[model samples]
Structures are given as C-alpha cells and as structure tokens.
Target chain A: MNPAVWLIGAGPGDPELLTMKAVKALGLADVVLVDDLVDPRILDYCPDARIVRVGKRGGCRSTPQDFIQRLMLRYARQGLRVARLKGGDPCIFGRGGEEAQWLSAHGVACEVVNGITAGLAAATAVGIPLTQRGLATGVTLVTAHTQDGGMPDWSALARGGTTLVVYMGVAKLQDMRGQLLAAGMDAATPVAMIENASLPGQRECASTVAAMADDADAFRLRSPAVLVIGQVAACRMYGAPDAPALAETRLRRSA
Target chain B: MNPAVWLIGAGPGDPELLTMKAVKALGLADVVLVDDLVDPRILDYCPDARIVRVGKRGGCRSTPQDFIQRLMLRYARQGLRVARLKGGDPCIFGRGGEEAQWLSAHGVACEVVNGITAGLAAATAVGIPLTQRGLATGVTLVTAHTQDGGMPDWSALARGGTTLVVYMGVAKLQDMRGQLLAAGMDAATPVAMIENASLPGQRECASTVAAMADDADAFRLRSPAVLVIGQVAACRMYGAPDAPALAETRLRRSA
Candidate 1:
C-alpha cells in the first residue's frame, strides 16, 4: 500500500470511547504519534505499533506543529502507515485540519477518524446537560487562549441563554468571570469546573460566575479542566444519588 | 444479571462511529428502545434483541416522554436487559436525564454510554474545524426546536466569535436566519448545512447566515441535517482537490 496518514481522535481520556474506526486505524498503524492529552492506555490498543510522544500541552515546551507535520510527512514517505492520535475529536480544536492539509500537500493520502470531543465528554462525565428544554437552548465550547495567549473575546461570551464550556480556562477563571460580568452577563450565572474529566481522579467544583473569581483557589483545578457556565451547570449532580438535590438547589436558587 | 437499563448514544447516523461501550451494550441487550434519528443499521449489532420504536420526531404525533419512561420501567419489571438507544450523545439534549431519573426512581439500574454527537461528526464530515488558531475560539451546539415548536431566542445566538452548530434546524432555516439577522448577527457569517451526515445520501450546502434561509430551499434538504455557522463552515471542501481553494476562501472572507 502507498504511504498514508490516519488522523484519529482518541476521545477525552477514555479508551472505551474510541470509535471502532479509530481503534482499527491504530491497530493498523506502523507508527503512532500520540499527544499529551490522550490517555496512555489507548496505546495498548496498538501493542505492535511503535509509539512516539509528540507532546503538545498548552503553555509548555512542546513539539512545534511544523515539526510534527514534517515527522508525519517523513514517516509516510518511507512507506509507513502513520497514525496521528489526538485528544477529543481531531477536527474540533485538535489541529487535525493543518496536519491533513500538510499531508495532502506532500502527496500523502490521509483519512480522518472522528472521536468524542471533550466538551461532550465533560458534560456527560459531570452529568451536566449542554442543552435543555427550558434551562438552556444552546451550548458554546471555548478556550481561554488566543494566538498571542491573550484572553478570548469576552463580550460575545457573556450572552445569556447559552451554555458555555470553556476548555483550558481554569487559570483564567478570574479574568473570564470579570469580563463576562462586565459584558452584561448575570453575576449569578451558574459555573462548574470539572478537573480531569473521564478519569478516575476527576473532581468537580460548582459555584456562581460571581464567586468563581474569588473562590478559584478552592477548586485547585489544573490544566485539562473544563469550565461550564449556564443554567445547565447548576443541574450537575455528584452521582445518581444527588440528582434530586441538584435539581432542588437550582429550583430554589432560581426562585 | 439483575434487571437494568442502559442508555446508549448510537452516534450520528454512522454505525462505525459507535463507541465500543455502546456496541457492547447493544450486544447484551434483551430489548432495544430506539428513536427515529438513530440509524437503522445499528440494529444489526443486536440481532437477537427485540426492537421497539419509541421515536419522537418533531411536528409529528409521537409517544409522550412519560409514556416512553413507563415503557422502560415496564420492560425492566419483566427482568429484561433494556437498552435505550438515541442518536448522538444522550446527555446533550436526548432527554436521557428524565429517562435515567425515571429508571432510578423505579428501582431500575441505569448506565449511560456516550456516543459521537452530530455536531462533531458534521464538522469532521465536511472538513470544518470547530476551533482554529485565529479563526474561532469557541463552538456552540444548539437545536432549532422550542418546547412549543417555535424559534429559540436568537438574541443570545447573535453574539459573534463562536462557531454555532444547529441540529434539526434545516426546515426552520428561514426563521433561524430572520432571527439571527434581527438580533444583529453579521450577514456574512458562513453557514454550512449537511443533510444525512456520515451516511450515504449525504448532501452539503454552503452559504452565509443571511443567505442560508433562502438558499437551503435550492438544495431541497430534508430532516437529520446539521447546520454549522461560523468561519469554520468555510473550511469544507467537497473533494480533496479543493483544499487550497477552501482555505483561500476562508482567508479572503475573514480579511
């Protein structure tokens, strides 16, 4: 077979969430290029394939995108089946498009296998509905970073009636809170920060947008955390047992 | 095993996109309760299971939510292994919560298996990136339906800078466009609608938010369409040959 590249999404830290297509692609890979956010256990699916870590963590010393693209090109040129494994759905903020473009430009065939995105996984893991009938009608997934590492456009995000899921936003909680509030967002809008979603070590912190900036230290959340803001965040229950309590709390607060 | 109910997302119309956990659940189910949006091909994995069509399509006389909940309860009472299969991720807007709550209250053990949502799959199927370095920092997933089958509040959706994915919104394209424009959304925001995404008979139509309402009629799109609006929608290339042209179109439009 001609050299080819398979861009696969590993889903959000859960190996079982991997699509059959993604798993098959990994099993057939001659070399697997994995990212930092992807669970290491996923490598077990391709026991025979050589694994290489092309770590790309935000705000860390990581492999440059160009270098990673070149590595994929080089490997494919040598008649190797290369798998570029990404966290979450590759097309959703995983930079898979750039990699696919580079591979296609270099005359290498490429196929993209979709995975469950972090926003969806975080919502499920925390029992928060991204959209509900009367509570929230829409969901917005965003990040805190810009090209120059500046804050995102907060004015647009402050719009009410939309659930906002912020990835890599824990550190900027204070700034984000202030910006949203300043842009006419209700100060008491519900906010929940989920740390390490889908993993055993997952932790959740619930608060209001007004309190997030002041109580940011209480969560002790790190990178890879997801921040959900809207009425839906208020509906999150710790487990099946807390469902009623969570709903009642929201009802009381809203009343 | 004790009587139990498993709520599984069947993925967005593609059998291969089902998670391993979902597939396993289907294999073990004694009865499968499915919705209209779920691809019929998924039933192939559960050949021995009794199939129940409890589908609730919009604007159609469908089974009430309470009625559906009662059916799950009845099935579990018979000591059956029931699987409630929904299209896309169950937690997002699938009413999985109500069903799970009903099951728990009735002493039926329930577990949710997440599946790939149409928003993410639609984005990938059409080569659109929900987020990019300088283009979009966020994405929003919403449905077009309200409880009374009217338009959702567009004032909140009109805010700029987030990619918007609308499920089941094709029939209401004209109303959606009017609402967005009235709420001050930019006229040129790119929008792409994919009908039957990830399935054979898939059709994609690209236009602006302002023009989509009128142009969607030209495509004669039907149900199960996923509409994506933002700079990302411009990333889609019908075939691999138009990659550069697509990118150029995005860049030129943004500039």
Candidate 2:
C-alpha cells in the first residue's frame, strides 16, 4: 500500500455529513489523529485503525501543533496511511495549512478532502441565505480568536453588501460590537448566533447587533456557536418569522 | 411515508463529492428539479425518480425562478418527495433561500442539505488553502454577477487580511482589478483562477493582479471559473513548490 497522508475534514460533528471520499479515506487509514472537535462516534467508520486524540481542548493543556506534525511524520515514515481528522473543513481554521505544508515539505504524498465548514452548516440551520441577491452579495468567514489574540480589522468587515460569519466568537461579541459600531456599521444590523449546528439540540439566538450580547445571555448560547451578521441575518426562515421584530429590539451585551 | 421537499447541493460537478445525506435524500425523492451545473451522472442515485432540468442557462432561454418555485410547489403538494438539486451549496449563491422560503410560505415541509460550494472546491483543486493562519485571517465569497450590475464596495475589501473568491468572476476580473486597484490594493496581489474545479478537466491559471488581464486573455479561462485573491493566493500549496515563480510567470487561462 502506498503510505501517504489524508487530511480529512469530518464536517461539524454530523457523521452523515462525511463525504464519500472521507469514508473511503477512513477505511484506508492505518491510524487516525483526531482533533477534539471531531465527533467521537465518527471513529467507528475505521474500526480497524488505531485512534489517537491529539487535540488540545480550548484553554486546556493541549498538544502542540509541532508535536502533532512530528507524530504524523513518524507514522507516515513507517508506511502507514495516516488520516488527520479535524472538526470542519481543513482549510477553514483548523491549522490544516501548516500541517499540509509540513507534510509537503517532507515529501509525503498528501490529499485534502474538503468538508462542509461549521459556518455553512450554522447558516443552514439558522435559515439565513449567506449570499442573497440585492441584499448581500458577499459573505466573509473569519474566526473570533486569532493567533496571540491579534485582532482582525473589524472596520473593513463592517462595510455593507456582505454578511459575516464569525466562528468561536461567543466570547468576543462585546469587542466586535464596539469595533463594528465604531466602524459605522449600523447597530441594528441583524445577528444570528447558532449553537450546536446540525445537531439534535441546536439552538439559535437571533437579534440585532445592539442586542446580541443580551440575547445570547438570555438564550444561553454557548461556545462553538457561529455568529452571522448582516441584513440577511434579519431574514425570516422560509415559512415563519421567528422574532419578526428582532432587528428593532435593542439590548446591551450582558457582561 | 413522509412527503417533503429536499433542497440538496449537488456540489461542484464531482459525483463522488455528494454528501452521504444528499445521497440518502436523493434516494427518497420521487421527483427532482436539477440545475444545469449539477453533473447528470449523479441522478443515478435516485433510480425511481423522474428528473427534470429547470435551470436557466446564461444567454439562453432559462426557466424563471418563479416558475421553478411553482413547479416545486406542485410536486410537493402532490405529496411527492421532491428534490431540488443545484450545483454547489444551495445557500452560497443558488437562490436556494428564495425557494425554501417559498415552500415554507406554502406550508410545505422542506429540508436543506448543505453541499460544498464551488469556491471551496476550486481552492482544494488548486491546492491553495483558502484560510491560512497569519497569511489569511478571513476568506470572502462573492459573486461578480449581481442583479442590475450594481457594485459592491471595493474600497473596504482592499483592506488587507482577507482572501477573496469571486464566483462567475471571469467577466468581471478586469473591472474588479480596476476597482480594487483604485481602492489601494497592491497591484502585485496574487490571483489564481480555477476552472472546472473537482472535475477531470480541471485546470488552473496563477498570476498577479497587474498581469491577470493579460494572463486571462492569453489563457482564455472561461466561465464557472473561481478567482482567489490575496496572500493566500500567493501560497504555495502545502508541499514543495510546483511552480516556484508562478506569479511572475505568465500562463494563459488554459482551456
């Protein structure tokens, strides 16, 4: 068997979301290095492979990325079909680029299997069309957390005509509100926060930017939520309008 | 048996890219309304269904979106499991939101199955990461063809730290190049155009903004191509450089 690495995106915890290529890759893997966000039940697809949870949970003692890279190389060198499974699309925010670059640098054959990122999944669950004609022509995907707490240029994103999806942004609503408001984005811009997207118990807190902080708290939205902001976010789902006046309601970010 | 309308994303022309959920939904459908971009071969999954092509191709007599919605309603009202298949993720650009909303307005049960959008598929096909740590903090998905040919605010996008993917952009690149250039983006910013992503005939043309007009003219890249711009566009896929000096070198949009 040709020993190469397969970087697979497990697709936001829904096993059925796995692509045919991902299932095939799992079947071929000799060992799988799974991140924390990956649904544990997904490992059953590769019953024959050894499973290693190399991911560090948020704010916990976690595996260093370099160590994970070294471990992948070690197994690949041993003629093993190594599969590194991340939570969503490997290209989105899971550090897949650095790992892919490392594997390429070492001359290991690699194939990246894309999956539905959490952002899209969250949008579907919340019933917002990410890019709508005449309403929003563009959608931007960014994370609330960045390397070393470096900030993203929120002002640029506040420009009209685009929707924004912020992954892992539950903790930054206050900061984002301040920055975006200062950047002149209307305080009434609709915001939809979807938690546990695609899962059975998923919840959504939809409101305008000015009230999202309080809405999130009142609704108890948690981590891993995908936050959508824009006119499209104000859109009512196909059949019924939930909180039809959400955009007009105002509340401060609850500390 | 439950009669419901399933809106499925057929993904970017690759039969194998269909998600497990999409396949399952296809199998349950009694009728399918397919868009032009979807590969016809994928219909085999639903052997028992009657397939209809309702897509309006560009520059040709096309099916009106309202007519398509009426057709979906007729089928669903008849208690048939109807599938509306569009190429790429339906939510990304396919007017899926409007369809789903229409169905809901009529009180018909509809479920949206997310599929990979063409932009992400193009990125994977081109071997460039859409979002890389530090290099690209965010990624934007937009379409060049908008209703009424109105313009998106190009000045804000010129703010660095984002990678842009423009769908149906071939016709608009020269215009975008001008707007973005005027908006203060670096003329040397990298751009990679991917045509027929995830298909056997897939090809790529990599160059810089300043050279792209000539490069696209020389290469003859056609519609359905995805344009990736920003620092990530300059990224060498996570391996040893395939063409180390691709940006400086000129390549026509290979047919």
Candidate 3:
C-alpha cells in the first residue's frame, strides 16, 4: 500500500500566514515531523497527532536525513497520515524534494502544499520589494548553506539587475561583498538585512554592500536574516516615481 | 486618515492556497483591484467588496502603471479599505513594490501578505523539486516581460547552478533559448513548461534547452506557463536517491 504523507510549509514563523489547506492538512495528520525552525505553537494545529522534533539545524546535532525518511516510511506503512511540517516552502530549501522522491520510490503518494518562503516574508516585513518596476526584472533566492560546496559564482548574479536574496549568509557578508564587487557589482548597491522577520523581535539594517558587514555587525544581525541586495532595497527611500528628489540620494543604483 | 490598503497574493491559481491572512484581508477590503490573470473565484472570499480588473498582461492591452497607482491612491485617500489582489506573491514580479511605495508616498498605509509563488506551485504539481540535495543550490524566478527594456544579461544568469524559472516566457522561448546558448550554457539543460498550473486545465511539457522552443511550439504551450530549466527537472527520472533504475529515462519531467 502507498504511504500517506503530506509535506506542508509552515510559512516563516507566522501562524496567520498558514494557508487554509496547510491548517486542514495539519488537522488531518496522524503523525507530524516538525523542523527545528518551525514554531512549537504550530503543533497546536495538529493536537491529535504524535509530534516528532526533527531538528535539522545546519551544523547542529540534528536528525539524520536517512533516518528521518525511514521513520516517515514506517509510519506511512502503518496507515497513519504522516505530515512533514517544514518551515517555509518545503521545496525551496526544506529538503522536501529528497523526502518526496524517497516516498515516490516506495510508491507513497506525496502532496506538497506551497507556503510563504522566508525570503518573501523577510522582504515584506522590512518593506523591501523583491521586484519593482524599472529595476528588478526578477528575484533570485540563494542560500549560504553551501555545506561542503564552494561559494557560488556571484558574477552573473551581480550583473542581472535581479534582486538577490541570500538566505543563511549572515556569517559571510565580507566574502559575499567581495565576490559581488569583484564581479563589477556597484559598491553603492543598497543592501538590507532583515533578521527574525515577522516575529516580535524582527530587526532591520540597511547599508551598501561595501559596508554591509559593518552594518550587520553594528546592528547585531544574526542567522535566519535575509540579506537583500539590489536597487529594490532602496525603493522606499527613493521618493515617488519621476520625482527628482531622490536623485541625489546615496542609495541610487548604477547598473 | 490613512485608508486601510492591503496587498494580498492570491497564490498561483488555486484559491485554497490563499493564506488565512489574505482571506481575512480580502473580506475586510472595501475595494479590490484584481490583476488580469487572477482567477475570478478568488473574489468569493470578498463577495461584499467591489472588484476591479486591472490588466497587467505583458505585450497586451494592460493597465498603465501610473494610472493604477493613481486609482489606488485616490480610493485610499477617500478612506476606502483598498485591497490590491495580485495573482502570486505581490512582491515578486507583481509590481506590488511600486504600488506600495506610491501609496506610502501619498500617506496610505499598506499591509502586504505573502503568498505561494507560481513557480513553486508549478514544480509541486509535477513532482519536480525546485531545489534538492546534490543538484540544485537555488531557484531563480525571472520573467520574459522586458517591455521597453533590453533583454536581461543572460550570461550571468546562465552561470549559476540555479534553477531558472521563467514566468510568461512561453511566447519567447526561442529568444530565451538563444541567449542561454550564446552565454555558454549547457545545451542539454532540462526545461519543463507548466501552463495553467494549479488549475483544472493545467498542462505540462518538457524538453532540453537546445530543443525547448520546438518542444514548446509542438506542445502548444501558451502564455503564463512557468518554464523551469535546470538539472533537477530531470530528478524524477532518476528515481530513488540511491537507486540507479531511472538513469536511462530521458527528459520525462512533463506531467
């Protein structure tokens, strides 16, 4: 028999952001595997379910990926409705892909309920538009969770006029800044770091890439902060469109 | 008095994907400016509110950016609870930033509620993970709407080992394919087109970068289809993480 598993995104620490579908899924789940970042309050949505804390925090004592998959498979075989509740969109950084593939291989049907990604939430909380007219043609969501991988080639990323949202890159602002600057990214490019977005203790700091490390350090920004790099970072600072007031503003971007 | 205005993302095309916050916001709205592509059924969440269709379709008769902003400002100044209901995440490519800034400049308070982006929904619909272990480091959400602007620098976009999700690129696949190839991108890069994603009429097609244009034409994929290009597109064909059974399956990413 196919395993009953649903991978649901918990949506960036905000319980209200949970989709009606995610809430319904949680209500129906017989067993839930919660991520470390997922708020414990979310478990209240699935009160009847047996909850397991699978803290997959980066570089921390966490559950092994293989073992987690095994548990899901075993519970699924027993006819329990297994819900893998992850923080943020399950597909985008949550390792939902691997679990889905494993479930599929074992003939378990998996349904993914998309949720608000942290990058989007972070941008919203800080009033930074990830994409705006005449500036960002797109938004690239990348992570500093490279693990064993080398730093990504930032040259192309720097040139595209797209908003670059670096997740988990708080520890290496200098390296990130150096790569973008070396790739001809303007030193004046505005940068904003939003930490603990949407939470009560959310903090925001803004500066140029050249001085981002200092600003981050000065602001005491920590991990889970989204680093926004692009022209859109200064959208609010610049006045109305066609208004020449912000022309002399130092945050002006040069492509 | 700052009119209560909300920027709500309706999610891809599925009404159920709407977040609880967005639903509540919609119900509280006195006037809602709906985008061209937004499903009409979404308005049921706000049956008492007045709905206005603001067409922002690329390369078509759409609403002017300035006019829309002005209307929003006017209604907001009149103290109407205005809700700008956009199809996907308002901040990502929906021009929500510009509108929000315009409203803020005019002293209108705007609250943004993040929603599920189409690219994530599209990938989920087909069982293709946008980011998975050992293959994709990130996902890039871009668009073919370069109206009045020159085509984006494809060279930089082609370098990163990130999944490229092109929104509204169905009509310009040839031009997009050419740029990626000229930028020295791999010829065999996988591509998947998901049209009408999350709707009953959804259709999916898959091919390689070299043959994507032809495949798109042959498949008759239309506008608004999300085109995914990266190695992970071929992930499902490779089967289990440890199993080598699906190694020989060629480009079976389509649903």
Candidate 4:
C-alpha cells in the first residue's frame, strides 16, 4: 500500500467548525501532526491515532520545516496514513502547498481539505464586517512578522478604503502602528486585536492604529492574536468608549 | 411566532463547503432569498422551502437594494422563517450588516452563519498560499467594484509583502491594473484570476498584475471571478512562465 497524507485545516481553533471531510480523515489516520493553534478537543475525534506535536512558535524552538517534511515522507513510506493538521485553512500561510508538492514529487498522494481562516472567523465573531458599502470594500490579511521582525511597507497599506487584518502581529503591535502612521494612515483609523480567537478565553480590544500596540500590551495579549486594522474595526458597537480607552491605557502601562 | 431571519453564507460557490449549521438553517427556512451567484445545487438542499431569486448581478438589472430589505421584512412580518442565502461569506461584501441592522431595528431577530470566502478557497484550489513565509506574511480581500463603477483606492493596496484578493473583479480588470500600476505597484507582481472556483468548469489563469486584465479578456472570463494579486499568487507552480516574461507581455500590450 502506498503511504498517503491528508492535509486538514482545523478552522480557527473551533473543533465544531472542522469540516466533515477533515473529521473523517482524522478518524482514519494512523498518525496525526497538529499545530499549536488547533484546539485540543479535535484529538477526541481520533482517539486511536498516534499524535505528534509539530507546532511552530516564533522566538522559540520549533520543528524545522525540512524535518517535518521528512517525517511525513518517512511515515508514508511505511504505509502509515498521516494527517497533517494546521490551524485555520491549510492553504493560508499553512505551508500546505510546499508539503503537498514535496509529497507529490516523492510519489505520495496528498489531499487538501479547507477550513475557516481566523481572520474571517474573528471578524464574524465580533460582528465586524470585513467589507462594507461606503466604508471598506476590501480587506488585507497580513502578519507582523518579517524576517527582521520589522514593520511591512506602510506606504502601500495606508491607502484609504481597504481593511487590513494582521496575524501574529501582537508582538509587533507598536511597530506596526508606527509604520502605518508613517505611511500616512490616519491616526484615528480603527484597529482591533483578538487574542486566542474562537477559543473560550478569547479577548477582543478595539482602538485606533495609533494606540493598538500599546493597548494590546495593556490587555496582556499573547501570541496567535489577529489584528484587524481599517474602518470596519470601529463597527464592533460594544456600546462603551471606556472599554477601548481603558484597554489602551492598560496596554501602555504594561508596555 | 415572532418572525426571524437567518443570514447564511453559502461558501465559495461550492454546495459541499456549506457548513452543517448553514445546511440546517436552509432545511428550516420557510422562505430562502438567494443571490445570483449561489449554485443551483444548493437549492436541492431546500426542496421543501420556497426559493426566491433576489440576487443582484453587476451590469444586469438588479432588484433595488432597499426593496430587497423590505421584502425580507415583509416576509418576516407574516411569521415566515427566512433565510438570506449569499454566495461566499455573507459579511464580506454581502451587505449582511445592512440586512441585519434593518431586521434589528424592526424588532426582528437575526442570526448569521459564516461561510468560507472565495479568496481563501481559490487559493487552496489553485495551490497558492495566501500567506507564506519569506514571501507574503499578509493578504488583503478586496472588490473591484466602487460606487461609480470605477476602481477603488489603489494607492494603499500597492503595499509590498501582502497578498490582495479581489472578488467580483472580472469586469473591472483593466481599470484595476491601471490603478495599481499608477499607484506604484510593480508591474511584475503575480496575479491569478479564478472563474467559477471550486465548481464544475472552474477555470484559472495566472499572469502578472500588468498582464491580468488583457489575458482575462482573452480568456473570456465572466463575473463572480476572483482576482488574487501579490507575491503569493506567483508561488503556485501551475506550469506558467516566471514573472518577468509575463510582465513584459502585459507592458508591451498596454503600451
């Protein structure tokens, strides 16, 4: 039997949102490779499968990309069904294509199952429309991490009439804000940061681009947070100005 | 029974991607107001329900926006369970908020069930990573439509190291290219346009942003096509030539 692999998207940390296809694959897996952002509850669906942790976290020891690929190949060569579980959708920043390409090149069959990305789920969960008529008609999903951990090109991002969503940006919130501001983005442009999105301990804070970094720190946000920056972030309608303002204050103090 | 409306996202034109929750809502809908882009196959899921075609198409005569809202209210007032089915996720340019707000103001309860957006699905189907390490750490979802049927603000969208996905953009492909070029975006930036993504007869063409509009017309693409622009668009190994040649073709043609 040829060893095969299934690449599954866990869907924004919500076990229930896992697609029927993903669930079926998990149940049939002999080995499961999961990322850090995937909810632990999903393991319950594959009680008989062997679980391996191959999650990557910034600024910490991580399983090398090449090593992970090798492990998948090795297991498949042994005729073991391997399931590579990724957070959110496998295609979005999950390096799924690379894995699939490698597997296909080595005569292994691979299938990609889609999942709900965190950016969309976070925007929906908070009642913030990523695109709205007469407000924002487009949205940009980005990350705060660069090779040097610096801000991305702000000159292009400050263009009006588009929403920007940033992933893994909590650590570089202040730098991102500074870049956007330097790029001529409005100081008052609305920004929202969601920590542990779709998880039970989820926390969402709304502020302006000028205040997001400092404010997120005060809220004590951790990694795996998603940042939504644009006019739509202001539409959360929490009914309290103090909530945003206080969160900013807390972030500034913590920083 | 108080009349309530549920707004459901149909997911990227594929009937199977519909969530179990969304399917349940459709099963319970007394009346379903579906958009033009929704696959007819989904209607099979609601054989017992009344299906209404209220979808607005670009360039074609569409039911007035206000009238659509009023129709929802009109149905709900008669104690009918209504499902407003939209192609792609409802909140991403689906005008779901306008409908939700209208319902809430009229004391009608509204529930929203999120669906997968086309951009992510398109990326997955074509093997492009929306966000990838050392390439793009971010992605932007944008539309090609504006209030006056012109291009949206392109200056802000030319930001480097980000992926841009445009929905309903086929008609305005040329305008979008010009605007992005004028806004300092590299002419060689990779772009992929997927027509009828994830469905039967799905067609995808890849070129640089400079060449996209011309080639798209050559392919005779239609509305409901998705445009993904950025470095990530170039990452897919779909047997296309590298970026420089594609950009040169676009430049020579436009010049």
User: Each model's TM-score?
Assistant: 0.91, 0.93, 0.90, 0.87
Q: Candidate 1 chain B, which ten residues in sequence have the lowest lDDT sum?
A: B246-255
The residue-by-residue lDDT of candidate 2 on A115-225, one tens digit each, is 999999878876788887777878999988677687688888888468999998898888888888899988888898887787765777778888777788777788878
Candidate 2 stretches with Cα past 4 Å from truth are A1-3, A240-255, B1-3, B240-255
Return the TM-score for candidate 3, rounded to 2 decimals: 0.90
B-chain TM-score, every candidate? 0.89, 0.92, 0.89, 0.88
Which digits, one per residue and each the tens of the lDDT, describe model 3 over residues B107-154?
Answer: 677777788888888877776888876777788888875646567667
Q: Please tell me which model should have the higher lDDT, number 2 or number 4.
A: 2
Model 3, range A1-255, lDDT digits (tens) per residue? Answer: 323888899988878888888998899889999988887878889999999888888788999999999999999989899999998899888888888877888877677788889998987876777878677878898886564677776887888768999988998898998899999988888887877777766777778888888777767778778888998887662233432222222331222
Q: Model 4 over residues B1-255: C-alpha lDDT tens digits?
A: 222888888888778677666787888899999999899998887999999999698768988889888999899889899998998888888887767767777767676677878888877767677776677757777778775666777776675557788888887888888889998888988887787777876777777888887888777777678888888876752223332212222222231
In model 1, the runs with Cα more than 4 Å from the true position are A1-3, A237-239, A242-255, B1-3, B148-150, B237-239, B242-255
Comparing 1 and 3 by TM-score, which wins?
1
lDDT of 2 by residue, B62-96 (tens): 99988999999998888888999999998998888
Q: Is candidate 3 or candidate 4 better by TM-score?
A: 3
Superposition error at B240 for model 1 (Å): 2.1
Interface CA root-mean-square deviation for model 3:
2.9
Q: Which candidate, 1 or 2, has the higher TM-score?
A: 2
Q: What tens digits encode model 1's per-residue C-alpha lDDT throughout A1-255?
A: 323888999988978899988888888999999999999999999999999999988779999989999999889888889999999988777887777766776777787788988877877776776776677777777787776778777786666467888887877887887789898888888887777778777767777888875555754567788888888887742345644223322221321
Q: Candidate 4, which CAPRI tier?
A: acceptable
DockQ for each numbered candidate? 0.52, 0.69, 0.55, 0.41
